[model samples]
Target: MKRFAIGDIHGGLKALKQVLERAKVTTQDQLIFLGDYVDGWSDSAAVISFLIELSKTHNCIFIRGNHDDLVHHWLKTDEQNENWLKHGGQSSKDAYAKLTLSEVEEHKKFFSNLENYYIDPENNLFVHAGFANMHGPQNEYEPYMVYWDRTLWETALALDENLKPEDLLYPKRFKLFHEIFIGHTPVTRINQTKPVNAANIWNVDTGAAFKGPLTMLNIDTKEIIQSEPVHQLYPNESGRN
Candidate 1:
């Protein structure tokens, strides 16, 4: 069976479809979505709908991103704060334009309850953001903070060698995994530029929602398949402008 690792989607249904089609994913294949399912683009509704449908037909696992948390907070609390709304939440608003309050609540509950992260039997892990260097697999709450915190990323990349991967036991060490599949940073290289211990982590958030590339990594084979940024493919798009 083929295992596919997908990057932060950020509501780019087109890019997601393009990559999946290009990869020729079949029922025999498995998929891991790194999140950022909403915000940035005007197609959040379409993308979420696609995800729900795809979940039925494929071996799919979805992890919650920071943006997903914000959207859920708004729906559950009836407060779309400036922080979340400004960070590309307008697109999600547009997507939820006609949704009744009940519908919003339903959607909100869905995202809010999404799993924080996933660890395969292989000990390979998948998360929207990388793990916290200081707290990994410690308290169950650790995954929540790690997946939503940006500061953790910098800290992990700068941890003291003694307290880092080699010195830790099991998955608590961010670098204990043979490979960590992540998406948060938007970059040209999927595996990120840095090398951490024996593990190689990738930042697959190819920035699709920002008119950047959409990337996918075949976990078992480590093959990268990418699709052109949809926005850049069409220079004359009016709404996308």
Candidate 2:
């Protein structure tokens, strides 16, 4: 069976559907979603519903994103930080307004049960974001680290251009995984519209929360599939600025 790693969806349900169809994902395939399934677009609730249905038929692994954490907190306490609202959390709140109480509960359960990170048998690590102060894959790290750490990617990018993979001294987290996949920080931040590979880390967050497209990478073959630009999918509104 093939393994596919999808980047942050950010409520772009249309883009998500397109990428999955383009990849021709089957029941036997393992689908790993890096995180940020909600917020940004107008269909956060719908996206969660789709994921719930998808999980019933496919081997799906969902990693909790910072946005997901924020939503969970809001669901439990009805409190949201200003930054969360500014960065598309308002849209998520609006999306959930349409769901029934039971549906909302189901969505809550789905988000609450999300994994912070996942490690495959091949030692590939999948997380919403990189870890900080990591000793190994098994070592416990802060939850925020899984959703906010950018130092790992930054260090890899700062390496000398002439340094070869074999000659590199990887950080503890990198050494623990054959390859690491992450999605919290969009690759667009570096002015790229596609997945960016730095050292052994592959970042697939193609900025679907704004102007870029959704991306899905076939982990085993390194085949990349992307949807049409996300803005086009939701012409009626500006998706989270």
Candidate 3:
């Protein structure tokens, strides 16, 4: 069975559906989603509903995202974070407003149950963002770093490419996993609209929340499937712009 690392969907259910169909995903395939499944487009609640149902029939691993955490808090306490509201939270609120109390509770459970990070049998690490500890995510003193840190990606990107794993200058974190897959930071920041590899860390977030398309990468083969730019799919709305 194939294992795929999917990028941040950011409420782009249309884009999500497009990539999955383009990839021709089968029930046997393992789908490791890197999170940020809500808070950008008009289908935040719908996306969660779809994912909840999809997990029942497919091999799916859902990693937690900072946005997911914020939404869950709002659902549980009715408190809205101003920063979150400024950044795509308003859209999420708008979408979730349509759900019944029971449906909302179901979504809260889904959000609460998301994994902070996932380590596969093959030693591949899947996280929504990055971790800070040198010993790896499992040893992080700050658990939230696994889903909110950008230093891991920054460190990976800043490392000298010529340095081999066996070299003394190599990072201990990189040696802890066969490969690391992350989302959080969109590759669009670097002007690339695709999954990017820095050392052994693969950034799968292609900025579907903004102008880029949603992406899915085949972990073993390094093949990719992407949807159209999300804004095109939702022309009437600005997606976290």
Each candidate's TM vs. the true structure?
A: 0.81, 0.95, 0.98
| Backbone clashes in model 2, listed as residue pairs | none
Which has the higher lDDT value, candidate number 1 or candidate number 2? 2
Write out the backbone clash pairs for model 3: none
How many clashes does each candidate structure show, in the order listed?
Answer: 0, 0, 0
Tell me the whole-model lDDT of each prediction, alpha carbons only.
Answer: 0.70, 0.89, 0.94
How accurate locally is residue 89 in candidate 3, as Cα lDDT from 0 to 100?
98
lDDT of 1 by residue, 49-113 (tens): 78877887999888888888877776667687887776778778778886776766667666866
* Local accuracy of candidate 2 as per-residue lDDT tens digits, 1-241: 9899999998999999999999999999999999999889998889999999999999999998888889888987899789899999999999988989999899889988999899999989999888876675346455677787788888777876676556645455567688999998888888988999987899999999988999999998899999998999999979977
Worst 10 residues of 3 by lDDT: 134-143
TM-score computed on alpha carbons, candidate 2: 0.95
Q: What is candidate 3's lDDT per residue for 86-145, written digit by digit as tens?
A: 999999999988999999999999998999999988899999998888888889898888
Sort every candidate by TM-score, greatest first.
3, 2, 1
